[model samples]
Target: MSLLVAWQLKDRRVLIVGGGEIASQRMDSILVTDASIAVIAPEHRLNSRARQLIACHHARITHHDRLFLGPSELHNIDMVLTALDDPERSREIVLMCRDARIPVNAADIPDLCDFYFGAQIRDGPLQIMISTNGNGPRLASRIKERLQRALSGGEGEAITKVGRLRTLLKQKAPGIGGDQGRRRMKWMTRLCNEWELEDFAQLDNAMMKSLLEDGWEKDRIPSLQDVGGTCSTRRYHQNFHSTIPLAVGFFVGVFTTALITFFRHRK
Candidate 1:
């Protein structure tokens, strides 16, 4: 299974080994991350959009205006993307990236890719990335569209509000240490589960201040009984019953052998 993860690419060095439309698509995606991007392709081969993007981000991007030469070019690069039309050159670039211990994505060649640029949906601090394990990018894009619509409401703003509330709770709430800390955390979690973005988003600053001032009152706080039982409680007994017989038999056999050996030695 391919492990999905989000990379922090801010100010990191990324090298792209093509300048056509495919390369431009990759460039557009990478540009948003504010990475130090360099495009290595002949100036004549570059598409108009690619050139424009490079020019716009000239401060952060370095256009080589020529084909990638050797593995030496891969030095100090955190990630590499090869969108070259020539399969042989693209394979060579992938090999060089492997040798340099750098992660690379070879465009249109799933076998050579160390990573795939999956379809993503961004909502303020929230980001969702979807991948089909390189089997189908089109399907991933379709799913992304569905998710985009699903999250079109105030989901992002709700997360931001929860974050702000959490910060306020940490600063203002007294008895937030020891057992009280866990109680506060459980109360906050319950609040998050019960409250929606609209619940707090419509409130004025004065109302918010008033709510915080009230703190964790017995009436306002969710009861511990309301929380669902833990997985351990549900599964532990089942596992213990299944394994105890085997465990007991193994221990009995060992003890029997030991006792027999001791009797034999005495004889």
Candidate 2:
């Protein structure tokens, strides 16, 4: 780990050196970055959705329709993503980017890449990064799917709340670290869990403000046991009627079958 690699393409120019399906996939990732993109390819082959994206979005991709990597093509490019089917062309693009000190991502070729795109889940200001370390993309994708199931939609909002609370704690409880900091964070996290804020988005700003102001004090912490007990009681009561109706229906069906069988035997 001698290298601590980081690249900033925010609001910068992104050049892609291919136009096939592989290049189209890379285009999707770069689009999210809001980077000004230009794709240079000799031909065009894309799905309907992909074609729509390139056409409607700010992606400034222009197909070369010619097999050549001219020096003029590198004009004002900050980053390059090479996804050409030909390894030799990809290698050449990497070399050009290296000489120019521009960041390059070569798909399916770790040796030629400056950065590897990982499975990323963005929840507002919260980001969960999952990387396979260039070993197994299938495993990375599997983990990403699980994370999506667990943390997408409302999950992101919950995490954002946690982050805001942590920031507030750090600012409010200065110099508190080790056991004290851990205890404070643990308690705040537990409060979130107990509240199940996923279902309670209407928590007033005043209450959130108060929580941030007084979250460090143990006395201010809400009773988790009482909250959980109430939730459980409510669930049981709500489902009790539904359960009874289903049970009665099942028994009636069984009894009717039994009666039919007995009458058939008598006859």
Candidate 3:
């Protein structure tokens, strides 16, 4: 079965049914979702930082301060995360959660888990998730580290710029559909690629508008010509926003320098 992927988890209820180090580690990942957390640990060995976050967020961490093997432990929870180190206990908890129609993830037991936590790398708005289909956690972690080093930089600012351009297109041409959508995507794809070749400030808005109009005209309906163009335009936009602040600063500095130089020469 293909693994299910969920990227957004704001304000969702998440329950961690352990109070030890493993549970603590899982909390670090779950907290990023900004979800409501209700931790049920008998005696939590939370470190300073984890405790600080738990206290600060005012998370509903109900402490049983004992073993959580009872059926009552699974009551009224949306998603359950069982981090108990014992295999049998973890399996039991998973079964209990399953009976209650609740999603559960037993520590180191991906087969039992309704949802498995992938090794994750977060860089600003960009998140890379790596999983090993429940075979090897260590392998997954190693791969995650490699991906972390590889994709440690760049983000979606360029993508966001393309989004803004598409919005502009929709505003200008209300009836942009079928060929229009294809054409808009094509122009966006090309512009985003070209954005890498020069400064964003050098990207003439008039030229972009002209190109977008032209592409839309051609692809207004899927013709044989459209297929060939789309085939040749297989290149997706590169990670152009790898140095966002640098790009922004460069543009800003160039503008200020030009303005000053123009006024001085005019004088």
Best by lDDT: 1
User: What's the lDDT for candidate 1?
Assistant: 0.77
* After superposition, candidate 2 runs with Cα above 4 Å error: 1-7, 42-47, 59-68, 146-153, 160-267
The model with the greatest TM-score is 1
Worst 10 residues of 3 by lDDT: 226-235
How would the candidate models be sorted by lDDT, starting from the highest? 1, 2, 3
The clash count of every prediction, one per candidate, is 0, 0, 4
* Model 1 TM-score on a 0 to 1 scale: 0.69
- Write model 2 residue lDDT over 1-267, tens digit each, in one string: 224343456768888776667778888777666577887765454445446656787435554555545556777989888876788888887888888888888887888887787777776755667887867788988999997865426655656666666666777666667876777767776776666545333333454566654545544664323223224333344477699889999999999999999999999
**Which rank order by TM-score, best down to worst?**
1, 3, 2
lDDT (tens digit, per residue) of candidate 1 on 72-119: 898789999999889999999999889999999999888998888888
The C-alpha TM-scores of every prediction are: 0.69, 0.59, 0.60
* Preferred candidate (lDDT higher): 1 or 2: 1
Error of 3 at 154 (Å): 1.8
Q: 2 or 3, which is superior by lDDT?
A: 2
